[model samples]
Target: MTALTLAAAQTIAIAGDVPANIQRHLAFMQAAAEHGVQLLVFPELSLTGYEPTLAAGLAIAPQDALLAPLRDRARELRLTAVVGMPIRVAPQTGVLIGALVLGADGSLAVYTKQHLHPGEDAAFIAGQGGAALEYGDNRIALAVCADFSHASHPRQAAEAGANVYAAGVLISEGGYATDSALLQGYAAEHRLLVLMANHGGPSGGWACAGRSAIWAADGGLLAAAPGIGDVLVIARHDGGQWAGHVVVL
Candidate 1:
């Protein structure tokens, strides 16, 4: 079987700065490519630093040409990257938290948050969610922040035949313990590998809890960032064995 390498990009965002954040993302992409990573996922609203008030003005259509640079880089490196941003399906539609899949083959896919935190509804609408990503023999299901809070979300992914459940979130330090435990529990109960990508610093005024992580299907800790900053929590599966490591960026 072909080896599969996945990484959670633990990055700090420049609040409401798309240009700067894009540059940072490119840097992470380069680092991940150097580590032979095939799939990389970033934190929620990474491009805009979880700033809800700015989402409407910052939101872009999924096909907007503004993402050309990121798309070009993904194709060049043959790396599939899932990046977070605010999106509007139509000019008249409300904004939604989006996780955009930039495929190595130059394909684009969209996954939006199906659930929202209490106050989030004031700024965004609940999405219908997106499709699974297929790579080699592995099938990946994508979740955004609050989407995983709903028990039915991951359960649906398992029923859909997804072996890997990846979530991009902006978790605050206070909520980290509870959230991480739930993610780990899902890994055990659903027998699905779980990967979490969290913000490395403050965003939307919340002190983010970095420590991005990956868990084995049985809920064993595979790899995790010690604290936070610019790092990559990576997991590799080859020859029927799983290995993990951390790369400081």
Candidate 2:
């Protein structure tokens, strides 16, 4: 079987600053690429912070120029990057919280959040269905912040034959305890390796709890971030078991 290396990156997002955030994303992408990572994931709303008020103004199209650098980088490194942002649903419509996957060969695929949190209804529209990005022997499913909270969200991915469940979130320190428990249960029940990319600092006025992490297929905690700064958590399956670790930037 072909081995896959996955990375979940946490960043301190500056609200409404697409250029700054994209630059920071590039830095993280570069670091992950250097680590020989094949798939890199970032936190929800990573390219435009978690500022719902500014989402419409900052919402980008799938082929926006702001993403060119990352595409070039992905192509250069022969990797896939799942970067988060608020995407314009359509002309004169609304925005959706989406993870846009940039492939090594300049292809793009998007996975929008199928579920929205209570307060998110005001500024975001819920997406439909689930998507799994295929690579090698892995089918990695994507999830946004509130999507992981709903049992049905990951179940759809599991039922679709996903072996990796990766999520991007903004979890407050107080909520981490509850959120991590859910992720653990997900790993155990689905029998899929779980990965999370959480914000490092304040975003949308919430104090983010970094704690980026990787869990084994059997629900074992493999590696976790220190709840601050820029951190990348990686996971890989060896012949016998899944091994994971963190790389601080």
Top TM-score: which candidate number?
1
How close to the true structure is residue 142 of candidate 2, measured as C-alpha lDDT?
91
Give the TM-score of each candidate.
0.99, 0.97
Candidate 2 lDDT trough over 10 residues, lowest sum: 128-137
lDDT score, residue 117, model 1?
A: 98
Q: How large is the C-alpha RMSD of every model relative to the true structure?
A: 0.8, 1.1
Which residue ranges in model 2 land beyond 4 Å of their true spot? Answer: none
Supply candidate 2's per-residue lDDT for 102: 91
Predict model 1's lDDT versus the native.
0.95
Which runs of model 1 end up more than 4 angstroms from their true locations? none
Error of 1 at 20 (Å): 0.2
